[model samples]
Target: MSLRTALVAHVVSSSFYLARARILLSPAGDNWLRGRQRHFEQGGVPMRRAFAASVALLSLALFTLVIVASSAQARSERTQATTITLSGWSAGKDEDDLLQSVVNTFNSTHSTIHVDYSVINGDYSTAMTARFAAHNPPDVFYVDSSVAPSWIKQGVLQPLNTYIKKSKYDTTKFYPGLLSAFKVGKTIYGFPKDWSPLATEINSAMFAKAGISTPPRTWAQLTADAKKLASSGAVPGGKPICLPPDWARMLAFVFQNKGSLASVQSPAVTAAVNYYVGLLKQGLAATPTQLGVGWPGEALGKEKAAIIFEGNWLLPYMKSTFPTVHYGVAPMVKGKVNGNLGFTVSYSLAKDSKNKQAAWTLLSWLTGKKGMTLWMSKGLALPSRSDVKAIGGRKPFLAAGPFAHGWGFPNFSTTITVMNNDLQAVINGSMTTAQMLADVSKSLKG
Candidate 1:
């Protein structure tokens, strides 16, 4: 019998209490109970004895009813298998093979709870928000670090701190500074999965043709080097480096300038903006249209531009599309400060999920050792956990993945527009450095 069934038996055996009481209350029962009763003593039972016997019988029946109900309650709470749904942005054809492998592994081992996964199109932000508004959100979904703050403000994400503490793996096991992107107040909203650093993808052939032997290590060095390469007439395009002073690239310069996006009062932002504009004026970088480059990856493949600052994702595309192009990866040079932007995404649970425990099971499997290793094997972004770096080291392609000082890009949610537009203006020569930063600072107040 099951433990539940055994417990029911114990409850039924407890009826012995009522049986013993009934026997003691009866005159015959009392005589039988006496240790030393005179032989052949026979007497009729008293009215009180008869009344006590009737009462004892009634009590015993009531007691049995209670035990039956208790046993029934226990059976209702038994463990049962559950089904959970997961949502993410791994819908692209390129990501299909890796994502499907992860889902299959989880489904095989977690027979009690199967994960029903769906990959939404485009960005997860747009798709997830719409689903939540419709009141039919998935149990779990992808949460990019860049957009986590918006979700937190909407009160949509759940905190995983308590769960993390109970986990065998500690938070410190992953890279520091990156986790805060998913935090609001004292609660952590998401689990960081993978990250890539900002780096320059150089065409070695282009560099050699330009009579350049070294990649620049600082902003000044980059400008000077690009100038030298330009004068050599060896660069395929008219310009040597294809730097776009767009909002994304501008944020990196702002970070490297020791400027906080949300600082109380600091002028470092202006300095960074000025530097970016200066580079544009000096012709170190070009706008997309000017270079006739539709995509950075395609541009690099066609050798339209010699050098471009991009993240780790570009590596695979370059290898597959431009297999013959001799290329090498170099770290992001120091601006006024040492910093780089991290292209990162995380897995987060819904605040109102019906199956919280089952949902966590899927999350635990995906972000844990097994899930991380499977994803890393595809040679995509680097894993957040330190131990997983060994897998990256096994392949030459992954070793050259984007990272500087072994750190990925930093998240700066504050002054996003200012960082975006201000730097673009400066680079495009539409605004001065001071004007761009001041405009950005004012924009932050809105």
Candidate 2:
């Protein structure tokens, strides 16, 4: 164990050190500490002097204690909190701010564990993979459900089963489906922090203007509604729906048709892909890029699309960036049955971490009720734990929770890159749906 003493800055910067400082700064303790210092100086023994300076240094930095503190009034041993590094990709400035604030609270309240939060820029999975290969990864990092399979296979994650059992952590609180997504066999790898199930978001004003009263309930009705909205020109220079060529989004339709990534060449998958791309082909749907926006959420907010399919993460963005945009969320339109894609992420521990127990302290708190409630209650994303209770118009997303399927591929990054290209190719008419399915099926085999 490395004990690097802390230099506390705030009056109550770190409770462990601050408690001692409070005593040392008092009139009676001040005189006592001073007397001990002179005795150590005259004797040429710097223990007392170092002790005094340690109290002073405690006022400056939040680190480990360097010396043993002794006084006639009390005798106690103190040390700095274990520094645990945590990294994840940022969703936006607002989300980053909220997470930072939460981490600050964790640091102050936790005397033995301090979490250092950093956003890994660019591709999250790619950067994390490199760090793991270098044997210098953060103590804890986000494990997106889409990449969990590959990460689990690589053995870079510290299994959470022992920690959970030892702590008697209640695993049943989280939604079973979400929790299962982070598991391999019976070994628990991580705890889901939050989840979002795909749903349809409709522009209220546009739907009314198109003479449609409600969001579409099925694929057929969605197409019919889009045609009416297009003919009415309600969106003006934009299409009736915004559909991104993402496997995560498309997988919802596949599941609805009783298909899965298990067999990309299945008849169910074929029908699902064709139906999804046909909208783009018929000019009733447009990608966010076509509408000059960054994401489907932005396209909806900018009124570039009458409808869009997204998860609950869009709620906070809409609230902050486009509060005035009148919209309604509904379950994703069905094919043969109800299905939706669930996106979840967990705070997983690194196998190479020097501070596994300390990292668990931070990780557990992050996914625990207190930390999760403070973060997820803001409508930032749907809470994975059922008791946390979603806020503000979240029923539609919750409705799809039962039939929602988690997304991940064999070789996550490479598979997604191939899937994304083939999906876009079919959408843009460069490739046929049949060719796309065959290629995707081939990639799955490889």
Candidate 3:
């Protein structure tokens, strides 16, 4: 073959090969090389890849900023001056003011913490249960003495034993009887914030009109005077002065009768109930419901009743609402048992609370003399602290009158239940005192 023909054929073949290669690989190859060059310029990232990387970096920075802001907000919450909500039952103006003063004082003293107080209002038990179920419970709440035991059993309250131990307070600083009320098993669920002596507040003028000089101390004397009061009709409201057939008081009477409502489940409680029923039948005392829709306090306050068995807390209320009334306080009429029935309230810490330390601090301050002073000033509660009494004794209340140093029956929640449930049923003629004893014994068994 001629050299020219061969060269032409070779060139055509080479051209054909180059054309085929370009058709098959040019677009992808060009893109890959351009990407590689861009990557080298951008620290080995392809153009598309660099764009994706830039978007990722921006997204990460935004996410980091969001996280930082959230953390900052959380930190602010931990140190904010806004209040930690405190939930409690509704008290009248005087009581509210006293509690507020304590809270305000604490807030002013401690710049880091503020307590926002709120009243749970009526049906406190039901409201608390609902709130607990919602997992939005109040940071602090007032627990009643009678109900604290049941709540502890149900695990609704956190044991305060650890906090109590860590506290600078000495448990012995309180009255042994009052301190014992808040103890459950081996743990203390609460601390005593206030206490009261149960006393019979009487209309001295009525007693004088009835020709009685002193308050009755024995059941027999009480019965006699009560009868005379009923017959004399010298009570201010023009109604016969009489004791209300209260189950709680009846239980106290049973206790004074040298009878155990449930402490010993014998036939004595039944006898006690029978005796109370007889008292009611004899018209010595009227049922609370029959007193013209008046509570014992109202009855006494309005002068419809000349006497009432109540706590010392009532004196302030009586003085504030019924200023001109002449009244006297005396120890509860003695029972044959020769002892007083009492109930005590205690403040406790919450186990699951986030501000446990702060809670403990508040509790410590409130239970101490400072809190006691606030409470005493309002006359809403009696101090559990003996020191507070020593600091400002008989002069606090007794200076205003002769009949101070009043006393109440000694009983805790367990005894209160017996008094209210078993003893009450017996007194109301719903059950024999024996039945009440048995029922209470059953409750105690568990």
Candidate 4:
């Protein structure tokens, strides 16, 4: 029987037993029983039968109280909700606020689960790794595609196949490219929360001042426009573009040229590198550090550069922080192929989490169609699911989704770190493009 039914039966039984005992011990009942005992002595009733009935009634009363108390304790446990912790890194105030709002909604809506959301402001992977090592990891946390392989190898993430099956979550709604990043063999470790593909951002005022009417459509056009903007002094210090010297940023060009970073000697790779080096040589492009800025977004916001290649996250940043800067976004410049790089982070449940079911509930809600739509409605990130429509001026970002490639390289974090450290030499002319590629390839192999 159901616990509720069992509890109701126990309560009724206890009340019945207590009533019987009270009647037996009452003054009127005692007088009547004594009269019966007197009659029994006269051979009308049995005295031994009366005494045995009193003993049995008293024992049942005490046993019924114990059972009632045990039933009450069990019912309390069954009604209580489970609470789980969620952890993630925040890029800025806007991103944090949006995440907290969604989390609030989930906590309020779920009757059986409570989520405590925490933001780790510093290095995300390092902080999360420490938590895992100490056996105090959050029940659910964000995992970047770049570092997923290593985490999977270490078996720190729980395989989500069973939860997905039991919940009947429609995994097919998500972009396959992003979803595959969290998979090892046939097991999925997480569900992608959101994704952002690199797109070209151009300052409209700068473009108009340089006599350019529209954003560039090809690599050659981009280079020509940069040169024109630089010569016309439309950008600060006559630098037309700010490109971060990182492989993550440069990979778009490699992929556009139909090249793989794994094969540095291929003609396509050589062509892609040569194109970037040529722009640097012409003084039309500068890295963010060279312009005394921390990132491409800042350089564009401050008018240090007329154009930049950045992610969709820049839209919210620009709206809130750089409100006066009029700009337009377009898909990344094309080459032999249409290519743009997509970066994504997923919600993963910890393998050792004590509240696994509760954690899964939060994960499912956060990455589900309704929750994801709410989170991406602000346009801080693009929705990973196909069914979620872009709201709040996210058309440009959504337009780039078709041809965007995810960060799927094996050991992606280490490879990007090595490239970021070594590629600066090539940009500054200390090393040739070929040499830089060779060095990066060798380091990755090692």
Top-down TM-score ranking: 4, 2, 1, 3
Residue by residue across 149-203, what tens digits does model 2's lDDT show? 8889899999999999999999888777777778888898898888889889999
**Candidate 2 lDDT (Cα, 0 to 1):** 0.84
**RMSD values, in order shown:** 10.6, 10.7, 16.9, 8.4
Which regions of candidate 4 deviate over 4 angstroms? 1-79
lDDT of 3 at 341: 46
Cα lDDT of model 1 overall? 0.68
Q: What tens-digit string does per-residue lDDT give for candidate 4 at 1-446?
A: 65456445645765665675577679987887787666656753465565555556546555767777678766775578788999898777878888899989997788778788889879988898898899889999999888888899888999999999998988998887788789977799999999988888999999999999999989989988998997787885638988778878888899899997568668898888788767777788888888899999998898889989998779877987899999999878899888877798899999999999999998998899989988976767789998998776677777767777777566666677777777888877688777877777776574
What's the true lDDT of residue 252 in model 1? 69
Candidate 2 wrongly placed segments (more than 4 Å)? 1-77, 289-294, 319-323
Model 4 weakest 10-residue run by lDDT: 2-11
Query: What is the per-residue lDDT of model 3 for residues 202-246, given as tens digits with 9 covering 90 to 100?
Result: 888888988889888776787788778878876744344445545
lDDT of 1 by residue, 88-205 (tens): 7863575776787788888888767878887787866677888879767889888877777777877888788777777654566555555666776668887777777667767788
* Candidate 1 Cα RMSD after full superposition onto the native fold (Å): 10.6
Off by over 4 Å in 3: 1-83, 230-241, 258-264, 301-304, 320-324, 390-431, 439-446
